[model samples]
Target: MRGRIIVLKHNTPGLLRRIASLRRSRVLQYRDAKGVILLDILPQGQCINAARYCSTLDRLKEAIRRKRPGLLRRGVVL
Candidate 1:
């Protein structure tokens, strides 16, 4: 997997979310040759603990359902 580094002048929180929420805006996503599949963004200075990890997994499952409907029905390797 690759990591993305976002540079911001301000240190305040919620700025990223605001920009992402704009009309027709886009958020970082996990992609493969097929196309975008999942979006999982971790807030600045935040750690991925159990609760957050579980929720991320839930979001990933939902994304798969929408983006690649047949993926789950067939079978996913990982």
Candidate 2:
């Protein structure tokens, strides 16, 4: 399966719209010039982990699953 990370130089908005077409990506490290663990993809989108919604990543997968189950069921990048 193909996978990639969402990156931003600093605090920005509307990332989901920018990469909305990409369904199987994780919200990896962002605004961290020094490099840090922003998001971690476990089994692409199907197997999302806790790290994806914490700290620098801030994916909010948990919330998405509860509120937006469709997002996860959507077709993956793979």
Candidate 3:
């Protein structure tokens, strides 16, 4: 089944500060046709698999923590 890709852009009003930041963050949320969250694309280009068949939010966060140690520290809340 083809899923819908939702890109969550950072809504912070500081355009200059966002550009000046070292890491250009991007969050992509994938959902199925029924509106169920499948997975998420985190900053630093990491994909967190949160599909209904496998994996959960906590597991995904742990995976992210392992992949990018500095991501959580940068104030990016998943």
Candidate 4:
């Protein structure tokens, strides 16, 4: 399984709620020294499938779309 990193501009409460709601067993969180929070969405277990990866990306995209659409266009990844 591979990992997908998603970086957000700021850690907003609404964004946190969206992430918490969509977070799965494979989802992990981290923050850098600059206080930038990153969500590492990875496929679980030994096998990596498209559906899992796509779903994860879709969920995150939807959450971002609902909260901050500008981030999506401006490139959310760091």
Candidate 5:
């Protein structure tokens, strides 16, 4: 991946959600538009504040379920 770099900002939680899915790494960041992410990626076996990460993951899962409405979550539960 060698090319020019780009940046983006938004008000909703879309960007963070996408990044969490693609990278699978916890990213605690805040942009100008503002995304108050408690946890970016809840990596396997990472116990960095279990309570918050679990909550964040739950919110993300709920959002996905609500939007997709047909995505059967089997096997690894996010």
Candidate 6:
């Protein structure tokens, strides 16, 4: 199966800096032909670097094992 990674950005406009701190988060998703395989929400100000990506992939592997055990045996394309 082939999978895709989607980055969803959530933005709020026009907030008073003094009154309230700005809040933002990023949604990271992994989906295959069937449906969403894994989803993660990154905390505000976090960036997607090698270390983070590696951790996310580790989680993804666990998810795959739990959700679709046969996928790994069949081989997957990312």
- On lDDT, the leading prediction is 6
Q: Superposing every Cα of model 6 onto the true structure, what RMSD results?
A: 10.2
Which is superior by TM-score, 2 or 6? 6
Winning model by TM-score: 6
- Go through the candidates in order and give the C-alpha RMSD of each one to the true structure: 9.1, 13.8, 12.9, 8.7, 10.3, 10.2
Prediction 2 TM-score vs. true? 0.23
lDDT of 5: 0.49
Q: How many clashes in each candidate?
A: 0, 0, 0, 0, 1, 0
Off by over 4 Å in 3: 1-55
Per residue, candidate 6 scores C-alpha lDDT tens digits across 1-78 of 123322324322432231123245556678777777776767688889999999999999999998888888887645
Determine the backbone clash count of candidate 3: 0
User: lDDT by residue for model 1 over 1-78, one digit each (tens)?
Assistant: 124334454434885556455434334566656865665555455677899878877888888888788878977636
lDDT for position 34 in model 2: 46
Tens-digit lDDT string for candidate 5 (21-78)? 5553445442212333323544555656778867766776665565543543544533
What C-alpha lDDT do the candidate models reach, one value each?
Answer: 0.63, 0.45, 0.47, 0.55, 0.49, 0.67
**Worst-scoring 10-residue span by lDDT in model 4:** 29-38
Model 5 spans > 4 angstroms off: 1-48, 73-77
Residue 24 Cα positional deviation in candidate 5, in Å, after optimal superposition: 19
Q: Which of the predicted structures, 5 or 6, would earn the higher lDDT when compared with the native?
A: 6
- Over 4 Å off, model 4: 1-26, 30-48, 75-78
lDDT per residue, candidate 3, 1-78, as tens digits? 123333334433654344335254443344334342333334465554556225556655675566555657979655
| Model 2 regions lying over 4 Å from their true place | 1-59, 76-78
lDDT of 4 by residue, 15-73 (tens): 65565455453555544355433365453353446986677567666666665657679
lDDT of 6: 0.67
